[model samples]
Target: MASSRGGSGAVGRANELEKMSIEQLKALKEQADMEVNLLQDSLSNIRTATSRLENATTALNDLSLCPQGLLLQTLSLSVWVPRKSKKL
Candidate 1:
């Protein structure tokens, strides 16, 4: 792939830096700095996406407990409420 070729090309350049002219070295350093910035931005986006997925999962789990809670409340009310007795 192109990415693999680019990775090897940078490794090859590392070995040839001493032979390069000052202008070429400066340009190479600038390119490397830009790549570092791009990778940092990508990592930040991934972290934000992961946090959002975790929050969504927690909300879904809480919603699933709602029915059980309502059933408990109804059962407790029926058991605790007393009926009036009729006189014979």
Candidate 2:
């Protein structure tokens, strides 16, 4: 068993890794790479969701500030129409 070190954990891990067989190291590397890919995918999804939420919030704010008469028209397009232009 490897002893746990606080700040020097990486050094301890390196030492332990040095004692591992080549096949063990290769398997470990494969598992680490898979985890990294999964983390990257999850992060990408989170970013996409955050962006969508921001866009929805901005749309809601814009709708809240719009004049009452244009509410129906705005909902139809789901976007803010220019206040100065009556054209769709």
Model 2, position 9: C-alpha lDDT score: 90
The sequence of per-residue lDDT tens digits that candidate 2 reaches over residues 1-88 is 3545564798888899999999999999999999999999999999999998998998888778867766343435446465554677
lDDT (CA) per prediction? 0.74, 0.80
Q: How high a TM-score does candidate 1 get?
A: 0.59
lDDT by residue for model 1 over 1-88, one digit each (tens)? Answer: 9999999999997879978999999999999999999999999999998998887788567657665423322235223222344569
The stretch of ten residues in a row with the least summed lDDT in candidate 1 is: 72-81
**Number of the top candidate by TM-score?**
2
Worst 10 residues of 2 by lDDT: 71-80
Among all candidates shown, the one with the greatest lDDT: 2
